[model samples]
Target: MMTCLCDAFFDDVARATHEVLESLGIEVIVPESQTCCGQPAFNGGDWASARQVIRHTLNVFQGDCPIIVPSGSCAAMSFHGALLAHEKETDLPQVQAFGARTWEICDFLRNGLGIESWEGRLDARVAIHSSCHSRGTGTPEAIRTLVGSIAGVTLLDFTQPEQCCGFGGTFSVTFPHISGSMGRLKIDSVRATHPDLLVSGDMSCLMHLNGLAEKQGSPLPVKHAIQVLRDARVTPVTVQ
Candidate 1:
């Protein structure tokens, strides 16, 4: 159950998550009918619409294998936001039950499967951007743990790593100037880390930061943490 507000990046993120799960020999069962987790409407303060989306999504993924999401925002929406909405409404008992099963990728890996280590190496410098949703959901440490599992990868710590990248779906559109300024600040923080790769759990934040980095001609490459972990596992092993 991977939900992404940005449809353009959802498949890529889902593929990355699936690839990692496969590499680890973890069987995944993706429901054919799952939809968006409704973070967009929820973030915009449109709880009514968000509840509708939530009900639809919950009904779709019904009996689950621990609903796993690639995006922290979506996971937060499923785990906390939807549950909050359900609490406020009398007609969403199913939504509350489904929310209990939701887990972010790193959260699933760290807490669900207890994956203390991974079996590959990137051999490069990387900086991790802790997204606001991830922080709010208490999964930043889980991300760090997972990143640390990869061999020969140096994970640099950025100052104010939890700052929002300003891509809160409609936030960028409704407040372009503010969003752009916040994005610039995030880019500057990433730049200050001087990492060869910038990684995050949320594709939205990565896309926002990546766009700014591209516009500024920064050499840093942006990628999802799952992508990097997948790359490490798939890269041909060398023997001395």
Candidate 2:
């Protein structure tokens, strides 16, 4: 799924996801009617509005095919959030079925495609931010394994690797001070490791951290995991 954040802010990440998936020979189908996963409303505690949005989402994305989502937050919202939105309704069964078909890109790459490691190389020290919503999704392991597999790619250790970057959809806007503080803490932890690039499955986290890092005058470079993979997979041309 091209998340609203990726669609709006990180079009490159969306393109990278499409390129990587197509490279794997997967017949990618993007329904034009697809919209936000209703995570903003859900996270904002507006179940009524979230249900309205997710119900439309459920109708738009109607195939039994695997629905690949790049963001853990949005992917989790599909199964977990949608269930909460449609609780006790007749649509619960369909929501459950939709959740079953949903897969985060990293999880799908590692498990669904049986890709254990990357043959390509990217010479950089990478720090992974396992987004808060990535929990229970098998994304942590998938991210570590995939990044660690690339030749010349060193996955560095950072404090609180599992910590949230403080972009909880509407949470950031609700409490900007707390959000900025949490973001600073995350940036500090990542800076301690001296990473060449900060990688994450969720662009929302990267967007928050990168912005904070820049405001603090550090400018932490970041990329979605799929973008890193796409770069690694591309064979560098010989100018000579």
The candidate scoring highest on lDDT is 2
Model 2 per-residue lDDT at 76: 91
Residue 232 of candidate 2: its Cα lDDT?
A: 84
Whole-model lDDT, model 2: 0.87
TM-score attained by model 2? 0.96
Query: What tens digits encode model 1's per-residue C-alpha lDDT throughout 107-168?
Result: 88888888878777777777888888776565777777887778887888877866788888
Candidate 2 structure quality by residue, lDDT tens digits, 163-196 = 7788887889899999999999999999999888
Instruction: Identify the runs in model 1 with alpha carbons over 4 angstroms from their true place.
Output: 136-138, 236-240
**Cα deviation in Å at residue 93, candidate 2?**
0.5
C-alpha TM-scores of all predictions: 0.91, 0.96
Error of 1 at 232 (Å): 1.1
Worst 10 residues of 2 by lDDT: 231-240
* Best candidate (score: TM-score): 2
